[model samples]
Target chain A: MLKAIKGIPLYLLALFLFIVTGLPFLIMFLTSFKGQMEFMTSPWSFPESFSLDNYKLLAELQFFGYFANSLVVSVVSVIIVILIAAMASYPLARLKFRLNRPIFILFMVGMMIPIHTTLVPIFILTNKMGLYDSLFGLIGPYIAFALPISIVIFTQFMRDIPKELEESAKMDGCSHLRLFWSIIFPLLTPAVATVAIYNFIHIWNEFIFALVLTNSTQNATLPIGLREFYGEFSVNIPGIMAALTLGSLPLLLVYFIAQEKIVTGLAAGSVKG
Target chain B: MSRLQEISLDTVHVRKKKKNKDTWVIIGFIAPAFIIYGVYVIYSIFMTFYYSTFDWTGIDANMVFVGLDNYIQLFQDDVFWTSIQNNFLLVIASLLTQLPVGLIMALLLFSPIKGMRLFRSVYFMPFLMSTVAIGILFIFIYEGNYGLLNAILEGIGLESLQTAWIGKESTAIWAVIATVCWQFAPFYMILFRATMVGIPEELYEAADIDGASGWQRFKSITLPLLKPIIITSAILSVIGSLKYFDLIYVMTGGGPNNSTELMATYMYKQTFTNFNMGYGSSISFSMFIIAFIVTVFILLGDRSTRGNG
Candidate 1:
């Protein structure tokens, strides 16, 4: 009887987390197909007809424009981050440089200060450079902000790459650039993949700087697009929901497809950090 | 013999020259990332400090330094205190709710269960979605009229319990905290489960051989092992909860009169809206001091725990 009672509660709790953790996403999915009257009347209920009406309406708009902008920014930034972080992390991990530890601690301190504190000043600087209202303004700071964590991830991963590779390359009298490019870069793909995935999601979802940096409708990214759609009020609910769904679907898909890598990436921090 | 010896020595010298160039190669590789990140982080921190003491708005050139005035004003400002209080409430709620809840989920999934791995991915669905979308989704959930929350309550025939959760001063902050905990708990749960997976299977088998029940095995094995991770996660939780912004901003807009305003949101408003640039920076500096102190405590605590373990 005691065992039976415990079993019941265990199942009940699982059911509860499953629901509470899940229902909001379910609602977002459900509401995208919901029409005005149906949404007002019954939000939790399934849509009366599976309608693409909302999706169809949103497609006619500049939907692809924001999608392109997000892709460009996130991809470009992720590429730059991986390249620069690979280069930076190699020495920090492998070399016995005098400044290496101090440089590493510097990154730790960088992680402490919230970027929001620096937003106003960066915005002012970006404005003065005439990079304001342009995509170029967003890229520079985005790379700057992403580098600390990327450097940390890469350097940690690089340490595990055996020292034999460097020694063997040296025995052959290979140049350092050639050694790294030919020997180390390919071996660090797992770390690069993990950091790239992490950075891509962050840049894709980021809103504040995108809002401040881009003034025109043409330049705004997906999150900013969502905020602007909010300003259109009640008439645009279905359209906005479609846009939100569109914005989030790619990430949801990637997370599912790369669940193992993502789980490994997360677990490393759990055990090690 | 002399000519042959000279030629061999020249080849050796060329090889050494190539290796020397390679030593600085690592430096060259890391330089760009370091330079860019270094300038931005170091420069912006002090620049904000300098601006905090001035009277000029973001656009203006006029700079007037009033020493310590902004810091003094931050203490007496009622809204600033309220924001700080709300942040405290979040720290408390997250510790109480998110941490334990994540542990429970982690433990449940940690045990052998059918389809638990599948459940893990599905459970993390909300964590992957944009905070902006989560924000909007909650606004719908908390809507006073024809909302999911009220509909569910009424369906269950608990009509009296229905109220404007995010719309009111009392419930608004708690409402935001609850959503945040729900969304993020899965992230921490995944982290904990990873640690759990690494524990040796032999320990559990040994417990069974000793006639230990499931409860006894979990208590003796799992709980004892999870301590380090729990400590690290707690520090992360504390630090993360302090900078809380995106979700709260989207839901309440810190409104029904400043109830859910976190430090980040409040800083944005003071600096950008009222143009109290100095005051805003002062509050930011204060928050930094608090975070640094907490971080020091975390590091010290981590060292002691790791040492004993």
Candidate 2:
């Protein structure tokens, strides 16, 4: 109760940080709707008349192709990674196996190997396998990088599940596979959601690989397309602003929808590590 | 056979078969992730090191083994050293500014202020958006003629302060670092705030009763409790800044004469732009070693800190 006055300064500081940090996003959003003349004349003002003309131009530029490509790559790779990570983590976390520690260490090494170190070789490998310039080429490397963290998260999550539950199921004459399929996987939804969201964002916003592996516009993901659009259409500031806004809309939507989970999930990953 | 001996033999046989089955089950479960990870990540790392030993452009199938020449050249390269220095600057900057700012933000939020929840989420917004998007936003913000930054300066009667932020060689890296700090400070804020929340309230209450000021209580109570997490966050920030690529890549392409060249972007430029595959591989290998050493050093520092404390 005595701290109510303290809240005034706190709120003021919060507002200051909020505006300082969020000013770019506010500017980006407002600038996207301004026309060329308006942008030039009053770059910081809100739009007097809302316009979607930049979006219309982007649509004509096959923006949806890039959107769909990003969606497919992020979603499919995350799904594959989730399934593989779940299967791998169950035994390591639950069962007593000879190779469990060694396997976990192997996954740990992946986390330490910076993605840049693997980039040149991945580029060469993808090209050799005829996957360069294809949307599919991104999936392999994405899954590989995604697997380490996914396995770690899944393993940590699985470790907390009581052993009595599995023991009871075993007493009911359940096979290991049936027990995992029926009982364990169902219990893993929250963990799976966390890993899925993390990987989805990672794959969606990943730039370097998408930059190197896929060269053609048709194969470009949102990041690549937005980058290419920025370079090729530097003259049209509003259009570039519009593309930036729309390009980030999907991720922003995901963040808003699962704000609690995203924050907690990322915190969980970093804190645990 | 005797009855007891026959029973023992039967049980042993059954247990052997079950053990064999379990081994296959383990293999089946772990194989998919392991295989993919092995091929793309672990194998690629080995291949990167192998490629470093050769003198070949990435364009063709042919290669010549050059032993350690690429590494020798990498050691001698001035630009490589410049990138390394830039990366060190990022690490120092993040340690000094981002962590402190994040800690301050987290501390401010520790109190039950009005609209605290909204402020927390909004503060983390920059971190949520893609780096590429942030890069584009900053590019517009830093535009020379009509950028928001210049406009703000002019509006504030500081026209002398306005300059092409990312366009000039001197200001490019600093501008890029500012954006990186903006994007990532929120990340550390969330991390530190989570740890701060776990601290017991009774400690603060006792300190208040003893008449300790806010800074005193924070120094004696919160800071000590949050030590492990502080180390962890520092390691994350340092390693993260070392491999920092996307935002910088998009913001300047390490440009205006390689002013913003990070180790990661330097590797990319060496490999892709120049087609110096061998040399690029050497740079990446060095990056890996540096990251490993930094991580190990932090862990060691953490251990010694814990030992002394």
Clashing pairs in 2: none
TM-score of every model? Answer: 0.93, 0.95
Task: Write candidate 2's Cα lDDT for B120-140 as tens digits.
Answer: 878888887788889988987
List candidate 1 stretches off by more than 4 Å: A1-6, A269-273, B1-23
Task: Give the worst 10-residue stretch by lDDT in candidate 2 chain A.
Answer: A1-10
lDDT of 1 by residue, A154-261 (tens): 888888888997898889988677888899999988787778877887898887788668999899888887776666645556566777788789998888888888
Candidate 1 per-residue lDDT over residues B211-246, each given as its tens digit? 887778777888888877887778778888887778
What level of docking quality does candidate 1 show?
A: medium
Task: Give me the chain B TM-score of candidate 1.
Answer: 0.89
Tell me the deviation in Å of residue A136 in model 1: 2.1
Model 2 over residues A143-215: C-alpha lDDT tens digits?
9999988999999999999999989998998988898899999999888888987788788989888988999
Docking class of 2: medium
Model 1 pairs in collision:
A88-B30
At residue B12, candidate 2 shows an lDDT of 100
